[model samples]
Target: MATSLPSHPIGVFDSGVGGLTVVRALMDRLPFENIVYFGDTARVPYGVKSTSTIEHFTLQIVDFLQRQNVKMLIIACNTMAAVAAEKVREISPLPVLDVIESGALCAVAESKTGGIGVIGTPTTINSNAYARAIHQMDPDCRVYSQACPLFVPLVEEGWLDHPVTRLTAQEYLKPVFVEQIDTLVLGCTHYPLLKPMLSTMTGNLKLVDSAIAIADQTAELLQQQGLANTQRGMPDYRYFVTDVPLNFRNVGERFLGRNLGAIEQVSLDRL
Candidate 1:
């Protein structure tokens, strides 16, 4: 795979629309690198699934992405990262990056008080991936985690700052506040969409946008691997989904902060 040219597209996948947050970050950070994104909408919300099931789904998606000849793989989904990241790394020939690793580094760097909170899907929080990652770099840092299952559905619904969203944020964050955490990790890509509401409610806790960390780290890795794209001008982007919901285009556009090109639907059966 190292023999592959830098011009090859980077492959990124998520359970559904939330992973677009990472896609948006990658576009902003590496404008010259083409991207191929896959969303497993048919199996959306890997949060509630067993670890084995999530790993199986992740392997399937990674296999499909590999068929596209992507130069790199970014496991942009938090739940998948929590459960299947190691298996992906062990099996894939491409360099693999995941949100938890970058997010942990950021949390450690941003936490002045040594008290950090992480919020994501129930599966992610239960897996303790973020906590383990943070502890690896800063053993003394206190880690607290919560699962904000409602946030994904709310973001998908485009009710970013709706009264209900705000109310839910308050409930989800109350325990973290009691811990007096000075830093917070938006464990799920979807949670970043609620930054305004999260910020207004969380007081001064520094929020670590894992998307930014992952983007920066990806750029660094690409440069180190000699895989950074040298192409000038615009880079092409292609999107795929396992199942296309009725409002997929609009929701995706909102998450991506731009117009979406052709979005094709795909299924695991083809693999």
Candidate 2:
């Protein structure tokens, strides 16, 4: 039998621009695949919402991506990944990948002392998703979780290295530091942008970003399924947001570490 070619773009969605981190990793790891990214900026900060609301929003985004004929879907937000991943998998026709479990697995694999610290949005920490996943992998592993609610806004405001970010990181990570964890997972995609401040505060703890792990897993899954895009030409990437900000292009360029072309705005209600 002749093999079929994979042509549909991979779809990635997040509550805001944070998921661009995952996109950047995907570009480096799977350069031949086209990408379609969606940001729920109009409903930004899914962290503060209830689980049902997050699930509803996630379903909507997944449906929109399905309409776009994406080959796979990536839930790039930790909170959504924690609360709605299975729900999405149940409903989505394409393979669905999430950030939390991938990060938890990486932290568990890297931890020598079985002490892992996770810092994420309020919803993600409160959900105990990382702790549950890590503990399930290794019952003896100790998981410490903290809610750094301000980190998302700080990252959105482009205050990555600001003194305020340092102070905030110190305050948020105090409990985790006291736990003496050997591995720290950046549970929120936005948290990676604040890595310098987090590292300075955590002091010697190994930091793990889910983006790389998710990218690696995505690559493996594609290969196994025989859905890997083998094109040698330059891949195309499209970005769409519920609400386009004035600095969307500039901020996105910094986050993705590359120039983003046109960004289209879409109405969530219509979708």
Candidate 3:
């Protein structure tokens, strides 16, 4: 059996800084737990990649995190979660938590009319993971999915409320609203960065941010597994990246909602 401990840092990875939203939520939800975050900055924008390529990249990150001795794993990237979560679980001895599953659960519980909408990258939407997950939970729930292909780039550019971003959001969400959904799942991790604007644009639609949902689910899972960190002082937080592109710290801190502190760059060859 794996010798997982409550004090072992939880491993979180994303194609890029998007997953930091989940890390931010986890910080707020579980203030005492240690965290180790990895961002594949060099090979980001995995949305355009093929299934086999995405899966290959995801497993490499999982293996690296496993070597870090994480007590648990959180697949914070929607694309990775949709494509490789099952594969990761098969090889990982540690408990795995994914944002897609958490978001689906939250959507089902929040939707009163059983009308749910999901917005994500082309890959996630194409995978039909959110709709399938939602339907599995509640067969009666109607799922409306949209591929907001530009949101990630807009978010990465730090145009959270730019006029162009707002216009794009309006154009992308129009069809979803036509379905009369009461709940909208921000299926992509990066989508949470645009929450304030999304909330304003999507009036009265309950927004299920996967970051927050996953954090809540993580807390519950830790409690159930008796792995909730007991020590309360400042916990360790480490960040690893394949490369530090221009404005990496700035964009990352924006996603994290705080200073990124010191970041260590690791080569992909190391994985």
Name the best candidate (by TM-score). Answer: 3
Determine the C-alpha RMSD for candidate 1 after optimal superposition of all C-alphas.
Answer: 1.3
Model 2 Cα shift for residue 91 (angstroms): 1.0
A best-first ranking of the candidates according to their lDDT comes to 3, 1, 2
Q: Which ten residues in a row have the lowest lDDT in candidate 3?
A: 244-253
Clashing pairs in 3: none
Error of 3 at 50 (Å): 0.7
Taking the tens digit of each residue's C-alpha lDDT, what string does model 1 give over 2-91?
456799999999998888999999999999999999998888879899988999999999999998989999999999999999999999
Pick by TM-score: 1 or 3, better one: 3
Candidate 3 regions off by >4 Å? none
The residue-by-residue lDDT of candidate 2 on 1-271, one tens digit each, is: 1223477789999988889999999999999999999988889879999999999999998888887778888999998999999999888667888998789888988999998988888899899999999999999999988898898889988899999988888888777888868999999998788887777776788999999999999999899988898787888899988986656677778789888888989887767
lDDT of 3 by residue, 4-90 (tens): 999999999999999999999999999999999999999998999999999999999999998898999999999999999999999
lDDT of residue 56 for candidate 2: 93
Model 3 per-residue lDDT at 263: 92
Q: Clashes per prediction? A: 0, 0, 0
**Residue 194 of model 3: what lDDT?**
90
